[model samples]
Target: MNLLSKIDIRQLQVLKALLEKRNLSKVADQLGISQQAVSEQLKKLRHNFDDRLFIRTSNGVVPTPFAQSLQTKVTRALASIEDLLIAEEFDPKTISTTFTICSTDLEQTVILPKFLTLLRKHAPKVKLAVKTLSLDDIDSSLLTGKVDLVITNPMFAPNNYPSTTLYQEQYLCVASKDNQDIAVQSSISDVAKIPQLVVSPSRGEFSGAANKWFADQGHPRNVVLSVPTFTAAKACIAHSDLCGFIPARLLPDPTLKIISLDKQVPGFDVIAVWHQRSSQDKLHTYIRELLMQAASE
Candidate 1:
């Protein structure tokens, strides 16, 4: 039989405690075990090592050369075990992780700049990668680690992912500063007479809810231009006679005039969505909070 095999980790721990305190009672107190228990562990340790590990002296006890030599290795091993058991608390400033977020052009222009600035002020080492979302590819993108989070309408979000609505986005009409039709007309029929710019992010199909709304009311829109993003729509509207709908949250430029449409275009719920794997992530949670704060502001 191997003597080392007979010795358990508890015996090693007791030996370490005994060496440090140089007293049996102190070792028991430190380990929260009975004095007899400590003595029994020490006896097993002594028998295994074939040494009088400690000897009583006038002060308390003196360690043998064997005990002194074993102390360093034992302390290091126990420290490592402790490290394995305790989880380190997260600190954002020291985090060097890169988060990839999926977003649309409107969100990139209106939301991300503020979010990035706030993130850098606290977690300077953390990095961000912004990618355009392909609604059809969301499942693979999230599962394969291509994107960490998505900022978009919850209606278009993947069902399996977790999401929180950051804010409600309402639509408002925008026209060029000199567009006479929009400036002079307050009725939906008169507004419909002017050419309209439409945002068709998926296929630039020149058709959506606005057209349907007009059609439902017996007057269809004459969509003269179709663009893929809000930025493009804004640029086209500012430079031409076309009028278009945009999110109310985005700040308008002086070259464009914002019009409150008489007809109601259903607003969307902008949500922050993430994969199931990141549901409990501390950093991801913090970033989500920051986004919510930015949206509220």
Candidate 2:
């Protein structure tokens, strides 16, 4: 006999319902079938599994050890099949899963606070873990489930992952409050002459638009420091004469000054990305929408 052609999915579902409900009538009610229909399914299941499966008792029925052993596997298989056919609806207030995010300091500072506040109001039980976006293998991490989401510059996002751009942001030149050169609004050339701080999150020795801007105009910046994070660059600018360009949305300290560049420095799009596998996940899509809303605000 061909085992594949002999067993039926409906029979497996009936077995799962029997294990949970433990009575013919209750299983029929739960499955929207009649008690007679349920018995017919159980009869087929008995022939397929070659066991008594369930025994009649005064309390209704009891599972045989064979049936009991198959209960967990049968329930899991049905649940997996159901999930493939229908997306489980998400109610944020009741969800208790933790979501891991890969991001940069700028996004963590600017985006996470608002997202957390929203989550507290709605999804109080949901948790979040924010880690640095791996420069080497973020795509693999996302695809393999090491990370659930990524929030960063769209330019840096992996092409294979599905992404939504939240907002477009430009960089603003920031100088310490007491830094006289850029404090009073100097030319971009003069600003370049001052010690500059470069943000290179990937730790690559490459030039950004500002550097290229200076080079095209026949002068390159005197880059005094290169850091792997925006927070480090912020602290460096706040304490020393070094000046750096940071995302404009992250309003700088009231004491610090922002200077306009002579030539527009190209800006980047901020985006939220996730693996294609999670595209249909209700919670993932909900959080992605929340991020877009917060970024807009």
Candidate 3:
């Protein structure tokens, strides 16, 4: 008889329980089976593997090197099976999980407020964890299950991963309402000459997305300051003589005013990206939909 023919899913379950509990009685209780049944399953498992998978001890049992090596593989297999079953019977209201999102200050300010409101209404029990976006760590973090979603410009998102464009965001040339030099309807050349504050979150350099636009108009931005976040840039621009481009959604501020340009500045698409492992996950799909809705609003 082939060894594969003798093995079954129940045997694998028994092996997993035993590996975790280490005691036959505990494994049996957890699985709602008798100790004799567990031992019988173990006996078959040992015979199939042709190894003494565990050794009897005063404490109950100890896994051999061979059995120890199987722990990760077995755990992963069981989790995958569980995910498969959950996908078929998923309900958003019943889910009680914490999802982590990686985002910049811009998304946190504009997207998260709406997304959180919808999330709370739809899945009250679901929690959220927000991590500041780190360009250097995004690839490894997504691959290692550190972040569930990334909300940012499509250009910054990981290449070839699953992503959906949430919305398009336009930039507004904003300056202090009190600034006498830069006024509304300021030309691009005029705005570029003023001491400009650039939001360069990922890098410390003074360059920004609007650099190419400025260069095309025969004017290079005189970036006098480089802040790491939009919040900081906004504060600095409001108090100082500095001006910079900010997302349009973050407007209506009492402290700053929008500087109408001679020509409209280009906008970029905001996108949500996730790991391929979550492509079939119901929760991820629903969350992506919520993001789109939130962006639209």
lDDT, each prediction? 0.83, 0.83, 0.89
The model with the greatest lDDT is 3
Cα lDDT tens digits, model 1, 173-250, are 789888776763356776778889887666667885478778888788789898878888888998998888888877
List TM-score per model, in order.
Answer: 0.70, 0.72, 0.73
Compose the digit string of candidate 3's lDDT tens values, residues 157-182: 78989999888889999999999888
lDDT of 1 at 112: 89
Clash-forming residue pairs, model 1 = none
Decide which is better by lDDT, 1 or 2: 1
Could you give the candidate ranking by lDDT, starting with the highest?
3, 1, 2
TM-score of 2: 0.72
The Cα error of candidate 2 at residue 220, in Å, is: 2.8
Instruction: Give the per-residue lDDT digits (tens) of candidate 2, residues 1-297.
Output: 986698888888889888988989999999898899999998988898889999999877899999999988988888888889996667889999999998888888888898888878888998998898666667888979999998877657788789898878888888888777565556777877888888777755446546876788877889878888878878788889888888887765775688766666678888888899999888898888788877877
In candidate 2, how many Å is residue 107 off?
A: 0.9
Question: In model 3, how large is the Cα lDDT of residue 125?
Answer: 84
